[model samples]
Target: GDRVLATAILDRVLHHAITINIRGHSYRLKEKLKAGLVRLEETATTT
Candidate 1:
């Protein structure tokens, strides 16, 4: 993956951006989780 090349692009994209943290289960994955089919671990997002 061209992560290094994309870093500059991402920096510009996030500049002056207002981010909101939305915590809670995703309704889209509700059925999957209930069926024991989805991942339960929480992974940190890349900056």
Candidate 2:
């Protein structure tokens, strides 16, 4: 009974959800790249 209620609530919540896809370089990582603190290869591996 508890699981059914929880699932119903989750379904209602996700019904109105919107997915956003941000396309761009991160500001912090861009600065780090400029400062030579983080390498491009490092970001590729970490993310």
Candidate 3:
């Protein structure tokens, strides 16, 4: 439930950010968000 909820929230946030703009700052943020998401998924699967 937590994983699903977190992913849904992250998707919504990323979608909103993308709609605003897809420039340098957002690009960097998107990368960081993606990395964090990957780690989250890995941790969830491992545990």
Best by TM-score: 2
Q: Please estimate how well model 1 matches the true structure, expressed as its whole-model Cα lDDT.
A: 0.70
Q: How many residue pairs clash in all the candidates, one count each?
A: 0, 0, 0
2 versus 3: better TM-score goes to: 2
**Cα displacement (Å) at residue 25, model 3:** 18
* Residue range 1-47, candidate 1, lDDT tens digits: 69986998889998999988988766766776687876566322411
Q: What's the true lDDT of residue 47 in model 1?
A: 17
lDDT of 2 by residue, 1-47 (tens): 99999999989988989967887679999999999999998998776
Q: Where is model 3 more than 4 Å wrong at Cα?
A: 18-47
Q: Residue 8 in model 1: shift from native, Å? A: 1.4
For model 1, give the 10-residue run with minimal summed lDDT.
Answer: 38-47
Q: lDDT by residue for model 3 over 1-47, one digit each (tens)?
A: 99999999999888857455433434544575677744544444543
Off by over 4 Å in 2: 1-14
Clashing pairs in 3: none
Best by lDDT: 2
